[model samples]
Target: MNETRQPAHHRGRGPGRLIALVLALFVMLGLSGGTAFAAPDDAEKPPRAVWVPDSAKDLVAAMQPSWNLGNTLDAIPDEGSWGNGQTTKATFEKVAADGFRSVRIPVTWSDHQSATAPYTIDATYMARVKQIVDWALDSGLYVVLNVHHDSWMWVEKITSDHDNVMARFNSTWSQISTTFRDAPRTLVFEGINEPSFANATEAQKFQYLRELQTSFHRLVRTSGGMNANRLLSLTTPAGAPEPAFMNDLYTTIAGLNDSQLVAQVHFYSWYPFSVNVAGGTLYDAVAQKHLDDTFANIRTTFVARGIPVYIGEYGLLDYPNHFHPSRVERGEALKYYEHLNHTARATGVTTALWDPFSYLNRETLQWRDQALFDWIKSSWTTRSGTASFDKVFVPKSAPVTAKSLTLNLNGTSFRGVWQGGTKLVAGRDYTVSGTRLAFTANALTRLVGNRAYGVNATLQARFNSGLPWNIDIVTNDAPVLSNATGTSTAFAVPTQYRGNNLATMHATYADGTNAGPTDWTPYQEFNKAFSPDYASGAITLTPDFLASLREGVTATLVFHFYSGQTVTYKVTKSGTAVTGTLA
Candidate 1:
């Protein structure tokens, strides 16, 4: 063989039995006399479980709240590389504030190569990467560490031919897996970047995945790094991880079982304005539902197996970068978020908005987009509603009017509210396409544990009769205000606090269901805080901070504070179908 293959002593080291099957099968299969012995067939194999990732899903979500970070990282220098360490720290804070819980730092050590095969990554780069990671890890988020563009070796022809590509892929990951052997647990690693196998046959791709899957496991185990059994995330060819096109990848991928790598899928699905169709964007029911249905089942598929997930890359076109009609692009993004939020919750896989800074139009941050800083700081909150409705709501504004929608609480059957124009029903299901209001019939009552387990947290699980819910919350004509610095001129929570204010109140009900006010508080508590900050324009607080002050078992509290004369309710979640208020 013209290509030099590394020695075999560097294989996996663990108590698990070596695969007698793999070896026996290979031997029985009979190798051609000319077959290369040094580079075994398992060269490009990924680990047993390629679910764990070395990128921060949290940081990626945070940085480009409106764009995808992994793709973005491919284009620019990381924050610390351009300025003092403070810039990197500040960037982390901004990302965390944006609700990101991890970051994937792409390292191309080859850039730092100093005329050598065992290229050394610069200490400066490592320090900078570490600085941002420390911020993310400290902020209670996940982090991903991987060798990135530097894996270009896998891109060129294997020995300028077919055989060598296999050899290099394994050698590269082996070296990579070894290099980060001592990184922290939170830092996951990825094996490759978006790779293209243009010349490889479909059969070869199948064989390649299986071989790479097995080898990835071996390399991580051998690198003797934290990567062993660590969460790893793999990518689909060219970042197009559509299930329909890559279903076989899953069938073959299931064989490697290290239990760390989570299932991963990328998406950029479009219609009407892409490929064959020539028209305005399709942010309508067709596009939204397609995305909803596709991802919903994918999550269900992985959840059954107990694997976690990450959206490695996904977003609308980023400015000068064209996907379609520039006019309707923002709306295109809004529909995407709605579907992602509603569908991804059960899988515990949120989103990492893709925005390669220089690649996007900054103004994409219009309206109530959580993707932009101003929107997040201003009106992009978890909720908004009427002040009048704020003071105790009991099924007032609209009535249930859909067909067959179910209302369940805990584990019992109860009547849910539905509305068509203005009517309510008790035992029927109503479906409203535009705007409908609903309240779950039963609230999750606090749980009681076995006497053996004293002082346990309340059990808050909902075991409904497995029915579908289809009700839309009315968007109040009057703007909803939860804090002083609201984006719109109309809706702003007045704040007047002398140190004591709850930010959120988790309220459960008699029927084993739940609902909470984004800024819940006792009337007086609300007044005390709201009076001063009414004119200031912002209020922020943590859920635990709210839990600290309690009035009674069934009361709601808002955990909020005034800093520099401004109330900050930094974190929030919103619902599109909230009724007046829970009884």
Candidate 2:
């Protein structure tokens, strides 16, 4: 979910070229003391080969099911300026109480530091970050403090500016290292988040990432105090999980001779399910295979070589306004979390969910989707190796009012139902058929007609029941559109009305011509597109759309929520533009 695309201007010669330039600059400057390029003191060095702590494996094991405080501290320009609410002490407490053992605090220091010489971070900003880190540590959570979203430093192509950028980068870390010099080992440092090499070839990008990591390792190690042997994390080239990228990273790291390193990579496999809404199901064979291949590669490339790996950020986009309309999307999102966490445990990788208040409400301290929260918790608690549930779809025109849906058990013996929600009835409304469940006629009718219906059942194992397992047989319903309003230059659909694919939307002119359901491309093709905010529940037409409207023309925008359910809002552009509520 933390896909930070490089800005267009950053593209140029790769890091290999920049390194040549950097070396030349170093020679020209002839200044060697206290810089990132400076060699470490031979006396302070641990050994020729880096000495990895015995606790490294234990640390990885403890950091299972980690959660990220994303989009909050890491917001560009300022914290909480982004849509996410300001993080409080209670935020970390809530996460830990809910069974998360680790937290990745992503913070951007670019705006908080001086752009000129020394590049000292503002004292107030540093203190605030320290307070948050202290809170996390106090809450008994492992904390990863990282240089996040520092696009100003990393996004630019290394050239004549390479020395200046590296100087600033080294200065920023020097300050950070000094500030947290005495902090406990639980406070891990991540060098960078999703470093981009916009101008580099694959080979160059890999080399550039290695250079960055090498510099980061050297700076942190030489910073003194606990940082000398701190458990540092580094990103793969572009933060990708590809075997080739990771293999290159592994090779580069081995040469670094540092054993106390954690390889951090982000996972958002299968874009159709992870980002777009066109995927069939989350637990389909294709999706599983993708995950399997990804983790397998990671395990083989990094984990097997005695290096710990962390999935610094991994999650599906489940914004209520955009992705929550389709039950398929919601179900798949939950399954993705479950499978990802389970796979993390199976392989020696720690997973951290990217929670920018998309699935959880930081303000109210409530889960936006309890089912997903429970599934994630169960995956961590039960450690169920392979868990899955049947996706129940009852047609509105079923012949019988009541029907029994069977749960498909994959060789594991079903123990018994642990918990069921209010939507399900144990005896009168439904009955169990071995591992299968039978819903009465009344229950079936309710599921068919209702907009939301589902029951979660926790099943036990006969033996070696890894974790208490739960499966949801959820009913799919047509998307609902409501509270739509519009104006001359803009039209608004309430967040609840929008669903996954805005591409399914079309505009019909009064003259019987139509436009879009536009393809997602350069983002400039269509002036008007749906932009929904899940937190605020506001869907408004962008200003670009209003400026592009033809004068003296009336058009009706039709949005297809599902196959048969379509909502339309009409707008007329006269001397002034006006609109009507969606119908």
Candidate 3:
């Protein structure tokens, strides 16, 4: 399905919805007399009954690959307020067509409902939610709808406001159950997204979850219609995949004795690698083990006990942080996704991508990176060969020499390398020894002809099976940085990358102590303390980094590059101003 293309067209636009808009406007403008007005009680049509009752295991299996509609309905205050486009049937249609079997619509209801007794959710918002769910169901995709941001918003207040919190939680689920009471079983209801209670101790955290999830279970069961047996998912505190949190969820599901229940958890890989801190720039052993162990534990804890687990959300923590540079490298991210999906399939765990238009563009309905998506889609059923890095850097100032890259066969055999339609000769142009793939100097010289400052050629390493690995031939030298003077809040050093890419930055004071906000590690987090603007030929030292420095102290900044080069520079903080000197 990812291979096909279709012309974009709007579909299933809700008719006569301007009245709902008028109601919302009145509420926003304080014209509703301080009480939110409910929409007309128009009898809603029931969804077409196409789902047959199935075991929780079977249901989760059918949801092999799922996608989340993140930052949209889940956005605080209101939908589309977080930069995502309005929800439409075409969104789900594209998802279903592109190989995602299910969709997770995270809805935040804090601002949409009343704060007092009955906790009345505005009828207009409820109907809009139903419209989106029905459209996904009609597109033949399973829908996992959940109480989204309300988790931290109000649900977490249970520690301080227990009575009122439970009241609102019960009322919210009661309305949700009644609305989808007759919908097909494909519509799964998740109680809460990442539930956590403030000021609660370890014992209280577990106790609070049991009470909250039990209430949700009871409310959905008594709502009648198909709701009596609808597949319900319960989550631990923060939806953490840790053993303690998962064990709590398992105990709760077992205590309920309902075969239609699912254990939900969210994973963002390892913290250091996830946020690209502490020199975790690569998906190394620690990061891979975190992913493997977490998934393996999920299998042993839930799947082994005849209980299904749904990884409600999984992705890098800083994935598609549109405002900053990528924390993880492109090839490294591909490896993470491939390993995650393959591991999920192996352990019978269902995973849903936590997408906030990070992978697919909501506006155009196209993948932001088709090749990256291809590796992900391929891993759903098979393995793809990858390498240590995606780029083959050749120094432009020197003669082209042979370059070797370690291959991550990923259980696949390497065939050869291809440049456009021409395949390089196995022995003459390139050679493979064990996992090492080396490009001969002759091959490098020919490929990097008239070497530019950026990528000069692209090569694809074809494997015996699955998708091919991409290798970019880039030309560059050690990046150059110039002295600069500016205030602590706005210091930008003139830089000329010369085609080389920054990997990490080390900051240390004259006394040899670590510098910057992250004092524990000399290597500062990418895009946090500092960021490189390759196109603009400037390196910006963020205010947070500068603010952490001591006045009159000179900190030596070492810029590490993926090309195995480092540029040293020194900066001294003088009260509110700072000066950078090229070392």
Best by lDDT: 3
- Per residue, candidate 3 scores C-alpha lDDT tens digits across 239-325 of 998899888888899999998998999999988888777888889999999999998899889999999888999888868566677
Q: Is candidate 1 or candidate 2 better by lDDT?
A: 2
User: What lDDT tens digits, residue by residue, belong to model 1 across residues 1-583?
Assistant: 1111111112222211243334334446873221111111232331110012233333222222222334323332443342222333345444543444455555454444332433444667556555655544443345665545643544434324545545555655665565556655555666555545546765665555555556666777766646664556665554455664346545644666555555556665563322112222345557666677777666555545555556655554433133321323332343344445435543456345544553323233222233333322222222111110111111212332221222223233333332333334322322222232222322101111121112222211122222212222221111123422222112233333322222222233333333232233122222222222322533322233233323222323223221112222322223211111112
* TM-score of every candidate relative to the true structure: 0.47, 0.69, 0.91
Each candidate's lDDT (Cα)? 0.38, 0.63, 0.85
lDDT of 2 by residue, 466-571 (tens): 3444434344344445554455556666645322223234566666555333323212121134454445555566655554556757667665532235567665
Candidate order by decreasing lDDT: 3, 2, 1
Q: Indicate the TM-score of model 2.
A: 0.69
Candidate 2, position 415, lDDT: 50
Candidate 2 structure lDDT:
0.63
Pairs with steric clashes in candidate 3 = none
